[model samples]
Target: MSTSPPPLTLEADAVTRITRWVAVGALLALIALCLAWELWLAPTGRRTLVIKVLPLLLPLAGLLKHRLYTYRWVSLLVWLYCAEGLVRATSEPAPGATLAMIEIALCLVLFAACAVQVRWRLQRAKAAAALG
Candidate 1:
């Protein structure tokens, strides 16, 4: 007798899970860095603080919940951070440039994690669908 596969959930593999958490952690770190860099460390001395921190909040819930769809879209959202970082890192002075470098690194981490997680989860889902 043949058996069918069980229903699939958003569940992922160990590597995918680790990657997702890494993305979430990197995103949180990036947000904190942006806050401190603008509001305290460098203090652009403008009302830019809210602008820097607000966009980050949009993805927090999805990332916290480990939603694959979030991983997919947030990966795209990260390029804005990367572009900002590249500009500041190349043109700004010391500490600001340094913080920009950190932002770039965090963005890269988040992007990589999101990509790997999405790929792994999609593959697993496709395989499961085939099995059933």
Candidate 2:
């Protein structure tokens, strides 16, 4: 018999896929809005840099939603983004503070949704594994 344990598994579902993409879509929309604000409404310089960094989160989010791998890594990333947002919030002044807070809240929501997706996928995989 093999000595190693089984690889982690997922039980991706259609509705789950749709839901994940919906979340991803909303995040992307936020990203676009941030970019627009950065290019338009934002004061300039570092704010653009800070918010532009957000686009980097997209690929990992897409990968997670696609089930390219287990969702744990993505969850960690989302948590990191939330932390970054919080740090930004602390540094923000009156006008920008609200936007920073909004970003933080959205990140938290994304984190929860991704975590739930992972849990739900694992549960389905476990049920299938048991049945088989």
Candidate 3:
């Protein structure tokens, strides 16, 4: 009486896999950038600024596991870093501004990867549910 939807194609699977890796790579790069900027390349007034990288570490395990919920939340979470990047890129002098621009680029990449993965997964799920 009922029919199932077509399974996701090899291309769809590959796209999701690529997005996952991109998200993880961008996150790691962002963490390293933050640490370098705050600790070595351009130390801020307060050494405590290095703590900013800590929050970025929280998502690694979830991302590595490809948790959909994690992707959704991380998309939202990345905005905070983007905001900081915007503020610093405009206000800070040369070295700090350069690091902030790098942070912004990484944040944009991470957000895009998370958003695309979440959207594609949700669409796949919805199509499967509707057909089955």
Candidate 4:
């Protein structure tokens, strides 16, 4: 009579939940900062459509719904933002450069959270399938 230990399903659930919230928060912060930076902070005096922040809104609904597929895709998508932030941070002027650095931080946090959530959720699904 061999019996295996029960899976740590609860721990996985908690981790997935925490990571999902973190990703959501980071995304929201990034959006807000982008809007504020573009609309107010910079000395650019000329008002332009805050197109830079619009792309992030595309995944907002899916992320709020806790869609694992969205998490996977957004994780990959954030790298583009990271690259843009890196470039702007180095070349853009003072406040703009500072905002770009903040963008980089937020993007990295969001990407890491999404990646961990996806991995944890996938592993949980696999474990559930194996247990049946």
Candidate 5:
């Protein structure tokens, strides 16, 4: 009788390791861009709304879809962003410079939260999968 192992699955452990790093790197890069903008950009509130916040969100969206981040938390964060944007838009004088700054800051916080949540989820999943 043959004692050969089954053919390697596409989801080999090593591939998951590589994928985890790739996911982390991509999210970190996006987060870094937000940090750069927050730190370096002058307090002029000069950027477009869609251009500024939308890109900041792409990573979180990816994380949620990929299960790198928890779906529930990511969904909540998306809702918060939408609410903040709406509030800032409606609050007198077009969200104001201060409001814009607040928006960006909140975005940074949300991204950080997503990062933490994704790491936690990945660790939990890894542990659960290893118990067999």
Candidate 6:
């Protein structure tokens, strides 16, 4: 007879659900901020900079679906925005610098949400396995 490991159930408790919503909200805010900053609030010489928002769009579907892999990868992905925000906040002036600061804040929130959701989910799964 062949033996197989039990299937893992990914359930969202209240905290996990809240974290997921927070992640989604932060992500949407980041996307909107990127668009407004590049196109309206402070446009660079080349509008091409707006392309930076593309990668942010990639995680939307996965996030909405609450995929664990998406949360894991997005936690790593948010750092790039943080770096960009840090660089711009230091180099740019006035509204651009302010916008960068906002970006940094949103990135931090998003990262925190992803990290919390992933940790909680994994812990829950481990506990379930133990009990099962």
lDDT of each prediction vs. the true structure?
0.86, 0.62, 0.94, 0.87, 0.50, 0.93
User: Which ranking of candidates, highest lDDT first?
Assistant: 3, 6, 4, 1, 2, 5
Superposition TM-score, candidate 3 onto the true structure: 0.96
Number of colliding residue pairs in each model: 0, 0, 0, 0, 0, 0
lDDT assessment of candidate 3: 0.94
Give the candidate order by descending TM-score. 3, 6, 1, 4, 2, 5
CA RMSD (A), model 5: 10.0
* lDDT per residue as tens, model 6, 39-65: 999999887899999999999999999
Show the colliding residue pairs in model 1.
Answer: none
Of the two candidates 2 and 6, the one with more favorable TM-score, higher being better, is 6
- Weakest ten-residue segment in model 3 by summed lDDT: 1-10
- On a 0 to 1 TM-score scale, where does candidate 2 land against the true structure? 0.68
lDDT of 1 by residue, 34-74 (tens): 98898878877584854777888899999889788898999
Candidate 3 ranges with C-alpha deviation above 4 Å: none
**Which runs in model 5 stand beyond 4 Å of their true positions?**
1-50, 57-66, 69-96
Model 4 stretches with alpha carbons more than 4 Å out: 1-8, 43-45
Clashes of 3: 0
lDDT of 2 by residue, 1-132 (tens): 544434543435564776587557646655755565556554557664646555446565555446735355656665665675688679877545666677777777666666777777677677667655
Whole-model alpha-carbon lDDT for candidate 2: 0.62
State the weakest 10-residue window (summed lDDT) of model 6: 1-10
lDDT of 4 by residue, 40-130 (tens): 8873556564787788999999999999999999999899989988998999999889988999999999999999999888887777676
The C-alpha TM-scores of every prediction are 0.89, 0.68, 0.96, 0.88, 0.34, 0.91
Judging by TM-score, tell me the better candidate of 2 and 3.
Answer: 3
What is the lDDT for 29 in model 1?
94
Question: Whose lDDT is higher: candidate 1's or candidate 2's?
Answer: 1
lDDT of 5 by residue, 44-119 (tens): 3544333554544555556545565443355355446546545654663632545544554554555555555556
